[model samples]
Every structure is written in C-alpha cells, then in structure tokens.
Target: MNYDVFNGDADGIIALLQWRFADPLETQLVTGVKRDIKLVEQVEVQAGDELAIFDVSMEKNMSALEQALAQGAHVFYADHHRSGTIPSHGNLDAHIDLDANTCTALIVDKLLKGRFHTWAITAAYGDNLIAKADELADKAGLDAGQKAQLKELGTLINYNGYGSKVDDLHFHPADLYQALKQYVSPFDAIADNASPYYQLQSAYQQDMNAAQAVPAVHESSKLKLFVLPNNAASRRISGVYGNWLANQNPDSAHAVLTENADGTYTVSLRAPLSNKQGAVAVCGQFSMGGGREAAAGINALSKDDLAAFIDAVETYYA
Candidate 1:
C-alpha cells in the first residue's frame, strides 16, 4: 500500500498536489485539522509500503516516522518546520529546510525544477510569506493582475485550514487537495468561476466580516489583542484573522484569541511584520505552544494566563 500523510494546510496540500500531479499514484490519504501533525502514526504501513509526508514537523512525528522506517516502509518527507536530528536510514528520504523564508511547497518546486512553479508561489503566499511570494512572482515575470490572483487563491486555501477540527472547515483538506488536483495550474482554477477558489473566497469574506466587527479587547503601542466569542466561526477564523491583523498593523504585535468551550483560549500570535521575531519565543513560554519565528500559536491557553500572555508579548516587542 502507498500512504500519503500531510498537514491539512495550503502548503501541505499543494506540496502533495505538485508531487502527485507529477507522478499519479494510488495511495491512502491521511490528514487532519491544521494542528494535527501526528499523521504518520495513523497509517498502518507494512514492509514494502511507500510513504510520502509533507509540511508537518518532523519533531512532532519522529516516533511514527521511525516506526514506519523500522517496519520497512520507504519514506519521503519534506517540511520547513522545526526538526530535531534527522534520522539516517536507507529507506528514508527526508528533505527539510528551516530557512525562515522557505516552505515545503517551495522545496518540492525546487525538486520538480518548477514544473508546478505557480502552485508553489501560491503556497508561499498562503503560508504568509508575502514578500517572498511577491519576489518569486516578479522573477517569474507575472504581472500585477496575475500576482494578485495567485495571492488571493493562496490566502483562501490557507483560510480553509484554520479550524480546530475538520467540522469547522469549509472542505476537509483531503477533499480540497482532490478538488485542486483537477487543475494542472492554480490559474486554471481561478479562471473557472465554478471552482473551490470562488467558494472559499465567498466563505472567507463572510467570516472576515464577522471577525472585523469585534473590536480589540486590549490595545497598546507594542501589542493589540482581540478576544473572539466561543463558536465554530471563531475557531475557523482566528488564525487567518491574526494574519490579517499582522498585515494591517505591521509595526505592532497582535494576538487573536478564540474562546474555547473549556473556557480556555486558542491563541494565534503574530510578531510585527516589520520585525518578524520573538513570537515563537513568546508562545513557547506557554504549554501546548510553539512555532516559527514569524507566527506561533497556543493550542489551549488558560483564561487566567491571558493577561500574562499579553504582557509577555508586549515586553518582548517593547
């Protein structure tokens, strides 16, 4: 059996899409909500089975990966997230780049020699590497109109991946991958009005409208915080809303907190786009939290710690 396990975000989905589009395969797909990184353990691979993994952190899935390799499954892994020491095994091929400006899709693009270059650019945009994506788009000779299209498509696909669970998403990541795989190029999907691009765009607009109406619960020169009500919509929109906030106020750090049912908060933190640093360190101070330097998150933060989190962010950015 062949299994493709990937993170259910724009980068993961599109990275796999580029690969499968290059080499069509019969495989079992394993994915989950954006936060579910332990996908490799879910696949029951036997000797001789093939495994392809993308976009998820190797540190989080190391045990499962070791298990798959020990079970004689040949594995190909690619990602840009934090990876502890990588294992050296005859049956495993791991491609990892921790560069702040790179993502898994871009790694795949490099491997494919840009056969699906446009999709890689879209993934970059979705991952919130705005300046990086713009540079690639310009180098590719894409006009302003074309670049805008790719940016919007990338943003929408990314927006679909933020939910706490699949139930809150517009389309399961697997289904989104399948839908997008039908088009050889992302522009093809945009050209067709009947594509997931349009559906996601509409849904994203509705959620953004609701999110924007809620004013900041706290604001200061160094940090601004918004607390959203507990609901599926809040869970679905908080991450993207954080991205939006970071872009809107590039000089100040921002936090988007969605009230969880357990009275905790699912937190999304973004360092000022002007200085994309310290967010990971700030979030790392909390349990169930850690991420890249530019953006990080806390899966569930105690209500009591909310003030402390804000203070930490402010102090770091100050």
Candidate 2:
C-alpha cells in the first residue's frame, strides 16, 4: 500500500500533483483543512507500505510517523514548517526546509528542475509569497493577465483552506484538488470549469466584504487590531482581514484575532510593510509556530492569555 499525505492547500495539492505526475502511481491520499495537521494518524499503514507526506510538518506528528516507520513503512516527507530535531531512520526520507521563501511546491519544483514550473508558481502565489511567485512567473513567460488569473485562482484556493472546519469552506481542498487535476493550469481550470470557479470567487468576495465591514478594535498611529466573533465566516476572514489591514495601513502593524468555539482565539499577526518581523516571536509567547519576519499565525490562544498577548504585542513594538 502507498499512502499520500498532504496538507489540503494549494502548495500541498500542487506538490502531490507534481510527485504523481513525475511517477504515476496508485496511492491513497490523506488530507484535511489547513488546521488539521495530524493527518498521518488517520491512515493505517502496514509493513512494506510506502508513504509520501507533503506540507504538513514531520515534527508536529513525529510520534505517529515514528510508529509507522517502526512498522516497516517507508516514508518520504517534504514540508516548510518549523521542525525540531529530526530522528534518523533507515526508511525515512525527509525533505524539511523551513525557509519562508520555500514551500512544498517550490521544493518539488527544485527536485524536478522546473518540470512543472507554472504549477509551482501558482502554489507560491496561493501561499502569499507574491514576490517569489512573480519571479517564477516572469521566468516562465507568463504575461500580466495570465499572472493575475493564476493569482486569483491561487488566492481562491488558499482562501478555501482558511475556515476552522470543513463546513465553513466553499469547497473541500481535496475536492478542489480533484477539480484542478482536470486542467493543466489554473487559467485552464478557470476556463474549463467556469461554474465552480465562479462560485468560489463569489464566495471569496462575500467573505472579504464581511471582513471589511468589521470595525477595527483599536486604531493607533502604529497599530490596528480587530477582533472577530466565533463564527465560520470569521475563521475564513481573519487572514484576509490581516492582509487587507496591513495593505491599507502600510506603516502600522495589524492583528486580526478570531474567537474560536472553545472561547479561545486564533490569531493572525502581520507586521507593517516597513518592518515584517517578530510576529513569530509575538505568537511564540502564546505558544505558536510560523515563519518569516512579516507574518505568522497562532492556532489557538487561551482566553486567559488574550489580554497578556495584546499587551505583549504593544510592548514588542514599543
């Protein structure tokens, strides 16, 4: 048996597509929304089975993966998440890189030497690594309109992965991947599958509109903070809101915090365009892991820590 485990997002889907396209094989896919990082435990791999894991970090699910490897299964993992010490195992082939500029799609592209460069670019755009995506797009000879279409598709696909639960999404990331597989590129998919693409675009617009309507909680000269209620739409809107706020106020840091079902909060932190660093440190105080100097995310923070977290953010900048 061969199991394909990936994060249910554009980068993961495109990475899996490249791997499968490179070596056409029959494999059971394991995936979930962006928040569902423990997807490897869902599968039951027997001895002699092979596993391909992408996007999801090996460190976070090291125990389950170690057990699978111990049972004689060979695992190939690629990811960009912050990983702790990687264990040495004969059957494990890990390609873990935590560089903010690198994603699973780009990793696969590097491995394959741009065999599927366009798809890698789309995944990069979807992951909000715009400068990197544009560089690849320029190298691939994509014109302005083509780049825009690919970016829209990438953003839509990325947005679909934002919700806290499956029901909150416009389409499940796996289903979106299945749909995408039919077309060779994002523009092809948008042209061939007009209905689904339009539907997703419309839903994205609605979510963005709702996000824009939310009043800012605090608007200082240097920072703007917004708190959203615990709702499906809020989960989907939080990231978009943070990005929008950062763009609207280029000189100020933005924090968009969404309340979760358990009375905790999921936080998206973005530094000003002028200073894109320390968000990971801010989230670290609340026990979250993310990348780069510009942006980071915390999965959940207890209600008790909310006040302290805000104060820390204030002091960090002060």
Candidate 3:
C-alpha cells in the first residue's frame, strides 16, 4: 500500500495535491488535526510500500521514519520545519527547506518546475506567508481581484484546520482535501458555488466575528495576549485569530489562548510580522511547544504556566 502522511493544514494538503497532480498515485492518506504531527507512525510499513510525507516536522516523526526506511519502504519527505539530522539511506528522498518565508508547497513547486504554480501560491497564502505569496502572485501576473480571491480561499482553508480535534472542524482536513482535489486550479473551486471555499467563507466570518469581540487579557508594547473561553467556536478560531492579531499589529507579538476542558490552555503564538523571530524560542520553553520561528504553538499549557508564557514572550521580543 502507498501511504501519504501530511499535516492537515493547507500547506500539507496542497503539498500532496501538487505531487499527486504531477504523479498520480493511489495512496492511503494519514492526517489529523493541525497539531497532530506524528503522522508517519500511523501507517504500518512493509517492504515495497511507497510513503509520501509532507509538512510534518521530521524531528517529531523520527522514529517512525527510521522504521519505514528499515522496513524497506521508499519514502519521499518534504517540509519547511526544523528537521533533526536527516537519515542517510538510499530508500529515502528528503526535501526540506527551513526558510521562514517559504513553505512545503513552494518546495514542491520547485520540484515540478511550477507546473502547478498557482496551487503552490494558494498553499503559501494558506500558510500565512502573505508577503511571499504576494510576490509570487505578482510574478505570475495575477490581477488584484485574483490575488484577493486566492488569499481569501487560502485563509478559509487554513481556518478550517485550527480545531483541537477533527470533530471541531467545519470539514475534516482529509475530507476538505478530497473535496478540493477535483479542481486543477483554485479558481475552478471558487467558481463552483457548492465548494468548500463557500462553506468555509461563511463559517469563518461567523467565528471571526465572535473572536473579534474578545479583548486582550494582556497587552504590552512587546506582546498582546488574548484568552478565549473554551468552546468549539473558540477552538476553531484560536489560531486564525492569532494570525489576525499578528496582521493587525505587525510590530507586536501576539498569543491566543483557548481554554481547554481540563483548565489548561492551547496556545498559538505569532511573532511580529515586521520581525518574524523568537516565537519558537518563547514556546520551546514549555512542553508540547515547538514550531518554526515565525509561528509556533503549545498544544497544552497548564493554567499555572500562563504568567510565565506571557513573560517569556515579552522578554524575548523586548
């Protein structure tokens, strides 16, 4: 069996989309919530299996990756996250770029020589690489209206991936991906009124409205922090709300905390867009926290750690 393991977010799904468009394959997909990074272990590997992995961090999925290589699986891995030392094996094909401005789909775009460049651009937008996506859109000569459409589409798809579990989402990432795979171009999906884009567009507006009503629990020159009440809506809006906050105040670091049932918090941290640095550093001091420099998150932060998390963000950006 061929297994395709990827993050449930736009960058991961679109990364795989570009590959399948370039090299059509019958593969079993393994994906989960945006924070579910240990995807490589989900597949039972056997000799001669083809494994395609994307967007998930290599360091987090190292053991399963090594097992797949040892099991004689031919593995193709691509990502933009920090990867520990890559394994040395002829059966493994690894494509990793740690650049803050780039994402997995753009890496796949390079591999395919831009055969599916527009889709790659959409993924970049979805990953919140706004400036980078704009540059690519300009280079592609996409008109202003077209660029806006792509950004909105990307944001909606990304918004759908924020929930703590699959059930909290508007559409499970796997389902959303399957729903989108029919379109060779994102614009085609937009033209189809029944597409996920339309569904997500409406839903996103509702959740974003609720999130906007939430004022910052902690605000300072270096950082602003918002703690949202626990609910499916809060879970859905947490990360995207953080992204919105970061965009609104490009000079200030931002954190969006969603209260978990256990009284802990799920944290999404974004460094200032103007100076994309230290997010991972700040989050890394906590357990279940790790991500790229521009964006990072803590899957579950105890309530007691709230004060420390805030101070860490302020100190790092100070």
Candidate 4:
C-alpha cells in the first residue's frame, strides 16, 4: 500500500501536493488535526509499503518511523520541526531543515526545483513566515494585489487546520487536499469562486470576529496571553489566532490558550516575530508541547499550569 501521511496544516498539505503533482500517485492519505503529529504510528505499515510523510515532527514519530522501516517500508520524510536524531537507513529518505524562516513546502520546493513555487510561497505565508513570504513574493514578480491574495489564501487554508478534531474542521484535511489537488497553481484555486478558498475565507472571518471580542487574559511587554472559551470556533482559530497576534505585535511573544471540555487548555505559542528563537523551548517545558522555534504548541495544558506557562514565556522573551 502507498500512504501519504502529512500534517493537516498548510505546510504539510502543500508540500505533499507539490510532490504528488510532480509525480502522480494513487495513495491512501493519513492525516489528522494540526496538533496530531504522531501520525506515523497510526498506520499499520506492511513490508514493501511506501509512505511519504510531511510536516509532523520526526522526533515525535521516530519510533513509528523505525517500525515502518523495520517492516521493509520505504519512507520519505520531510519537515522543519525539531527532529531529535535522524536514522541512517536505506529505506528511509529524510529531508529536514530547522530554519525558522523556512517550512516543509519550501524544502520540497527546493527538491522540485520550483515546479510549484507559488504553492510553496503560500505555505510559507500560511506558516506565518510573513517577511520571508513577502520577500519571495517580490522575487517572484507578484504584484501587490497578487501577494495579498496569496497571503489570504494561505492564511485561510492554515486556519482550516486548527480545529481540535476533524469534526471541528470545516473540511477534513484529506478532503481539503483532494479539493486543492485539482490546481497546480494557487492562483487557479483563488480564481475559482466555488473553491475552498472562498468557503474558508467566509468561515475564517466569522471566527476571527469572535476571537477579537475576547480580551487578553494577560499582557506585558514580554508576553501577551489570551484564553478563549471552549468551543468549536475557539479550537478552530487558536493557532492562526496566535499567528495574527504575533503579527500584530512583532516584538512581544503571544500565546492563545483555548479551554478544553475537561478544563484543560490547548496552547499555541509564538515567539516574538523579531526574535523567533524560543517558542519551541518555552513550549517544550510543558507536557505535550513541541514545535519549531517560531511556533509551537501544547496539546493539553492543565489549568493549574497556565500561570507557569505564562511565566516561562515571559522569562524566555525577557
């Protein structure tokens, strides 16, 4: 069997889309919510299987990766998140870069020699590499209007991935991927008024309106924190909301915590855009927290640890 395992986010989906567009494949897709990074284990790998994985942290999925390799599966893995250690196995092909300015789609773009460069730029924008994406956009000769469209398109795709579960999302990642696979160029998707772009834009605006109404739970020069009420909308907007907050105040670290049904919180943290180096470290101090340096998250933070998490972010930025 051939499995395309990817994070449900824009980076993962676009990375895989570029690869598959260049090399058409009839494969089963394995993906989940944006935070479900341990996806490699979800698959029951068989000998001779081929798995193309993207976006999720290799460190979190290392054991499952090893299991797949041991079972004689050929695994192609690519990501930008922290990868503890890479294995040297003939059956495994890994491409990982830890640069905060680059994402998995950008790496795959390099491999594809920019066959789908526009899509890669969109992924970068979606990942919140705004300055880098803008630079690339200028280099690509995209006019101001075009750049704005791509940014909005990328942001909407990314926002669609933030839900706590597939049910919370407007469209399943796999479904979203297939919807987008029809167009090799992101512009084509945007031009099609009857596309996911339009759908997501409408949904995103509504969610953002709700989010903006919630006042900050804590704010300081070092860090600004907001705790959203538990709901589908809050879960669907947490990560992207963190990105929005970080962009709004580039010098202050931002955290968006969404209350869970069980009173725990799902935390999304973004290091100051001016210094995108400590988000992963700050989040790593908590259980179920991990990501790239610019953006990281804790899947479930106890209510009690909320204060500590805030202190950690403040200290890191201070």
What tens digits encode model 4's per-residue C-alpha lDDT throughout 147-224? 999999889989989878889999999999999999989999999998999999999999999999999989999998
Q: Largest lDDT belongs to which candidate?
A: 4
Better of 1 and 4 by TM-score: 4
Query: For residues 1-318, could you state the per-residue lDDT of candidate 3 as single tens digits?
Result: 989998988899999999998898888989988899999989999999999999999999999999999999999999999899999999999999998999999999999999998899999888889999999999999999999999888888888888888999999888988999999999999999999999899899999999899998999999999999999989988888888888888999999999999989999999999998788889999999999999999999998999999989988988
Query: Which RMSD values do the candidates have, in order?
Result: 1.2, 2.2, 0.8, 0.7
- Listed in order, each prediction's TM-score against the native is 0.97, 0.91, 0.99, 0.99
lDDT scores of the candidates, listed in order: 0.91, 0.80, 0.92, 0.93
Ranking by lDDT: 4, 3, 1, 2
lDDT of 4: 0.93
- Counting clashing residue pairs in each candidate, in order, gives 0, 3, 0, 0
Clashing pairs in 4: none
Candidate 3 stretches with Cα past 4 Å from truth are none
Name the runs in model 1 displaced over 4 angstroms.
Answer: none
Give the lDDT of residue 318 in candidate 2: 75
- For residue 150, what is the lDDT in candidate 1? 94
| RMSD from true fold, candidate 3 | 0.8
| Cα RMSD for predicted model 2 | 2.2
Order of candidates by TM-score, top first? 4, 3, 1, 2
| Count: clashes, candidate 1 | 0
